[model samples]
Target: MRTYQLYLIDDEFASHYFGKERMVYQLFKDYKEAVGEYKKILEKQIDFILKPIQEIKIHQFISQYLQKNKDFYTNNGLYYLEIGKRSTAKLEIHERCLMLKANGNYEAETIFFEVLRKTESSFIAIDLEHQRCGWLKPIKERKFV
Candidate 1:
């Protein structure tokens, strides 16, 4: 039987569901590797995951990030957060959120809202904000299969 893993990436929150523990490790390796893999998957499957979003919405999302963080932007609206800068990088906020999700360290709803609030508040506080940015919007509670 072909095995599939379900990975959830909501703003910052991310989770993976697998029938086997070993498989999860193989696919994700660790939180950092998993985030990198998720980015690759998102790029490769952009058409599919982004299908529900209108072109303008997609553009707006990418544009906002570009405007907010310039150096990280690459062509084609893809922004990469460098590894050494992960701690304070706005892009890595979502990665930290994902790490929290993977470890079950935070409540999904709370973490989602907190990340949003912090991002917005931090943006407002600084004359020029330089940090990783992403948020988790609330969703229906998920139960692992």
Candidate 2:
């Protein structure tokens, strides 16, 4: 499981630095505490960004905040991997799901995995065929004609 931290970013300060760097006012582990302080800052009309972050390899934390399932983002659903014609689908394993940057392929087979756990970027799934568990993300490139 990954730990989360909230950061208060100063957009005005970052603008001076060419937007490549941001000035963080503070880091808080508690969401409510951060939000409470965030509200206070908001009342002052100051520019800042408050967000909860997990240390994914690439930062993809642009999702709505939910009170429940803070540890891991919950998005329970089925994941389907459709192998293209003359192509393959595969499942790759890593120390963490965030580290996976590519999708796997299997030849001539359509695989369905029941999603046991879901996050913003990846899914913890069990393969129905081999009864194996691994990290997977749903593919959105397929189109139905």
Candidate 3:
């Protein structure tokens, strides 16, 4: 038998669920109260009404987070080591589109990921196999009329 707990595997997943990656599983300082609530949720026993947690805009939090993570700010590039066959293509495409839109502001927006088999390659070996799969434009099929 195996057990599993809900854990966002990466920044992308966290970003999708919690509005931002930096918001991953933080304690509310009142450890007992927070854990109590969590346990209740798991046990389906939360009876007492609790105040709603206020929501902060993801953009605002992302700004603060990126400031702290200077490397992420400086890099300004998204990478995909592998395009999993079972992965959610729509989500990946959404992330890439966001990056592409921000290209004007950052000027280094690119989704650099490896193709099948090869760990890396020269610039000439572009992975056009899935160009239409997760980009702003259709893969290499621009009309020239």
Candidate 4:
């Protein structure tokens, strides 16, 4: 199944669904499209606030990343954050990726890159953003039955 999620760019930025929804980034077709439209609002800014969203293809087993530090994929706000806190990073899942939100949105890709730094070329991490099908493994290892 293909769905959309949002990782707030700033940790201090009041999360829209925090507490009420620990994982506020729900998985649904409408939410996905809504996020796409929301992303546009952030794009209009000349300076930019939210981090670029990474496309996670849970069904296809494919994932996307920023590829560069502080680099993002779109101006759209949905893929990014709502811009409540302009200078924080939140929502990084990987243990090594943990950092103060004062830095910026601690996103999945951040963890992905962090993992790459700590592990061998073969190590891999399943984008936990998927919720149901997420794990970290090495490229050389095959655990799937």
TM-score of each: 0.26, 0.18, 0.17, 0.21
The deviation in Å at residue 84 for candidate 4 is 43
Q: Model 2, 37-128: lDDT tens per residue?
A: 67665534422332222334222221222222222222332112333433322222222321111133442122212221233323323222
Residue-level lDDT of model 1, residues 44-111, one tens digit each, is: 54223211213343335445544454333434433232223322122222211222111122232232
| C-alpha RMSD by candidate, in order | 13.8, 16.8, 19.9, 17.2
Task: State the C-alpha lDDT per candidate.
Answer: 0.30, 0.28, 0.23, 0.30
Per-residue error for 11 in candidate 1, Å, reads: 16
Residue-level lDDT tens digits of model 3 in 46-145: 1121112112322343344344432233223322222233221110122111221221221222222211102111111111222221212212333598
lDDT of 4: 0.30
Number of colliding residue pairs in each model: 6, 7, 0, 13
Candidate 3 vs. true structure, TM-score: 0.17
Q: Predictions ranked by TM-score, top down?
A: 1, 4, 2, 3
- lDDT tens string, model 4, 8-92? 2322222332232323223222233455756554344311323332223221111233324343323322222223443332322
State the lDDT at 131 in candidate 4.
44
Cα-based lDDT at residue 118, candidate 4: 36
